[model samples]
Target chain A: MSSEVAVSKTGTRLRSPRHMLADSATLGPFLTLLVLFVLFSLFIPKFLSWRSVSGIVNAATPIGIVTIGVTLLMICGEFDLSVGSLVALGGYVFAMLLLAGAPPALAALLAVALPALFGLLNGLLLVWTGIPSFIVTLGTRSIYRGIVWLFSGGTLIQMLERPAVLALFNGRLDVLNELLPKGANFRTSLIWFLLAVLVFQYLLTRTTFGNHIFAAGGNAQAAAAQGVNVSRVKVISFAFSGALAGLTGILLFSQFRTVRVTTGAGMELSAIAAAVVGGTALNGGVGSIWGALIGVLLISMLRTGVILMDIPFIPADNFEAVVGATIVGAAVLNTWLGQGRAKR
Target chain B: MGRTQDHSEPLVRMEAIVKRFGTITALDGVDFEVEYQQVHALLGDNGAGKSTLIKILTGVYPPTEGRIYFEGRHVRFSSPRDARALGIETVYQDLALVDTMSITRNFFLGREIVRRLGPIPWLDMRAMNERTRSALRDIGIEIRAPHEKVGSLSGGERQSIAIGRAVHFGAKLLILDEPTSALSVAETRKVLSYIENAKARGLSVIFITHNVRHVHMVADAYTILRHGRKVGTYYRGELSERDIADLITGERER
Candidate 1:
């Protein structure tokens, strides 16, 4: 019996240096982010300054939180295009409740829950009708935005009241501000973003639900055959994505004290871009929340770099073109790395 | 039906089984029995209701008419999960494994070993990995690590893992659908030996295949089905490979 155990060739092949590098999902994105950070620091005079670094993180907070949810859903092999509208819907709900003399805690809960419900609807539609999530979320995206438009009468809803509860969401970090030099502006939203990343990354790596998410996305039929309840997993993933988007809206409104129909316009594409750039596969079943965070940081850094460079031909307003190119390049790099592992 | 007092009854017995798909009668009054600690080969051509019979047994579809007896008691399964709950596990050709996941992860996929921290249940990675390694070792397979991805494994190794997982999870009656249909000669030999290993460990396996050679390798008893009806069931010494082939193709009457 001992002689019958033929040693696998993969045991030797996996020890190779290339395979080691390819095996870690976060390494590629992390390296790219480091390279970009160095390049930006060298070319731009103030790029390495505390103010510039903090600004990039600040800009990444809302989209970064949204991308975490998108990454989870993407790993489960689905998309939520309605997330941008859900963000706006979340902001509207929160602001409306606050104006109606509701407690800030209750308002925040309802805001998050409402968007999560919409996300649940997206999952149910996909599961029941057997439609692709891309299409289902796309249709709901416009419908959700329209609902926001009608609710707010296509106008801005601004609040001047700065309740203590609002500070928990996006208040400036007073201690850090006092310790650091002037212009080093940090906010509570960054803490919220980091917390979201930690919790979700843990969810994807350590939990049973996370295992099922990978299995569900990797092979739905195979997962179902093992009694994994794939539909329920996917629906839960969709709801998570929606809840995150709503949370992003709360972060936005808390900082700016403003809500409008166009609050989260075009955010879905950015969130997807960040997730993809972080090495999340479009096909599902393979992704990392950590990679996605690096992706968000990389894109935000690019936006800042492009603006600071002040190149005449590639102006700040045209930063999206650079981000788009980064997305395609990162996707190609991810595929090449993935193939290297599979080829073994 | 009352439970049989006799301890020597067959592990599974299906009497006068019939299945209909709308206007089509896929199976017609087929009777099959698998004894304890035996490799029972179910040989048939494609569309000979091999799948339908197994599906009925595994609870994929309810039988239109028939009674199933397991452990000498009349039983019916509403879903594949119910069958699994009764220690009846079917390993289809595809193996129902997630390729991108680790061997240990696949080994304990739906039935993961977990420890609770506060209210959250976290995967007990150490326990699962150790158990997977030892379980495969018990089945004469020594894997270097349990964290190796299933995609990186050979076909024989993958089959070994699937069979090992089923056996480790308490599968008393294992139903393997074409366990060697898509393997090289060496890989097929490995899978056949795994089936033997399963039988040696006190498991009753219903090995379904169209290949006579594979049946000759591991089967203790063979049942022949042609055109949704059983030609006959025979002991290993009663029929040669040629006789079994001819019976399958209906060129020779039973």
Candidate 2:
């Protein structure tokens, strides 16, 4: 509607304090991770040890992987509570396939594919039924966990004697071996986790699909008007969440050589916590993979710190208190960073 | 009306369109047409089947008993994507933009320029940014950076960007659904002028609004609907703003 109305003469657009704060919102998570790392190292000398650092990275791998998908789905304004259940389901699938004489790689692929399929179903149900994703995924969560229990017969699936299958994921990196007298036990899962992060980060920031995701999540009606298949975008996001959970399950299985019925029982909450701590808005359309990476690292470090400190009040088994506290704290900080002065 | 353009074929024509949701009829029978290179206004009150008519034309829904012709060819669009593929773009009042996204991304939301590197198409970020800057500038919307988020922009600025995007993408029929209902007088004028600019560029516009005054300034023809039926189609010079308003509000007996 161009008439005699001139271009906005609002002067040169200066970066306002509001814009700066919004930018800092993303950086907030990374900064918190850095601050926590420094504080931990200062107070707990063990945190500075190469062993502790490696252990933190190793433990962070599966959680980081799960966080990647959860963060992506969250950015698209959907939640997948079933990821924890999917992880357990995947472990059972892998274990069952391996026992059935299937090659480890094939078992692993099927394991990943199963959860991806479930994710697709979750997304389709959400889109087609016009139900809130939280409700749909919440229903699927228990259903998937039940399926896993049925298959496993409520018994632990254990393969304690490590085969080449387990070795592929839990193998140590030779490069870091010379740095530590005990030999660097850097788990291959960490490499896989970081690789997933880099790939997803590229997808979210440097691709057209990534742009569509933000659009769909930010405003579905707007996205639909632009001819972006919002339903497809959401479905794909759910699949990513489910598939990553499966991969994390595989990693967990490889690391411990055991899959309990409750292997990933409360992991969905922890994964969400990690993403929230990394500055991912639960409301959606504003987040980063790098932030989630930092978040998972922070979560792992906190868990490890509590265990190392041996604080009588906060037992190692009760690390969830720290996680719950961090989630609340991070959520508050994120809101503060995003809260700009109201527009006049 | 206004300047005559040789009475060529209309760009879009919907004949006796009737839509029903269950037993309730939204549109009984309505005929609407928009000539090429003219701003056609659709005026109606609430529940006057204006939304139903627009939805049918835009492929959001198919009429229960009606046929739509685009460029004199009968067509049935199952979804909005199909309609968009045929060069029909609708800019809703909300502007259909993701505020959190960069202006460049919003400009090329579904139609992104990608470098065909391997199987995965990587976004041509630099090219897209440059194009968005020039595109918005052509429409008299100047932002400091194309990479700036759309949320930071004012309401009118966002509408301009949406209009610019539709124009750049070669839309044959640009539909504006109450584009000025939420804008200030200045912003409304700016948007109205852009509609005029679009008409000059040979794009047919379906300007849907209850405000007859704004439409009077730009629309070459007016189609007024009342009680899910068309009252009449009047040319610009044939009716005053008051007459059109009465027609929309059903104040004047048929």
Among all candidates shown, the one with the greatest TM-score: 1
Against the reference, the lDDT scores of all candidates come to 0.89, 0.85
Measured by DockQ, the strongest candidate is: 1
Q: B1-254 in candidate 2: lDDT tens per residue?
A: 14344456688989999999998999998999998887999999999988899999988898999999998789999988889889899998774788778899999988899897888778999999999988767756676778767776677878888998998888888999999888889988988888887777778999998998888889999999898999988897999888888778878865
Candidate 1 lDDT over A299-340, as tens digits, reads 999999889899998999999899999999988987887776
Q: Which ten residues in a row have the lowest lDDT in candidate 2 chain A?
A: A1-10
Please state the interface RMSD for every predicted structure, separated by commas.
2.1, 2.7
TM-score of the second chain, each candidate in turn, equals 0.95, 0.93
Estimated TM-score for each candidate: 0.94, 0.89
Candidate 2, B144: how far from true, in Å? 2.6
Of candidate 1 chain A, the 10-residue stretch with the lowest lDDT total is A1-10
Per-prediction DockQ? 0.58, 0.54
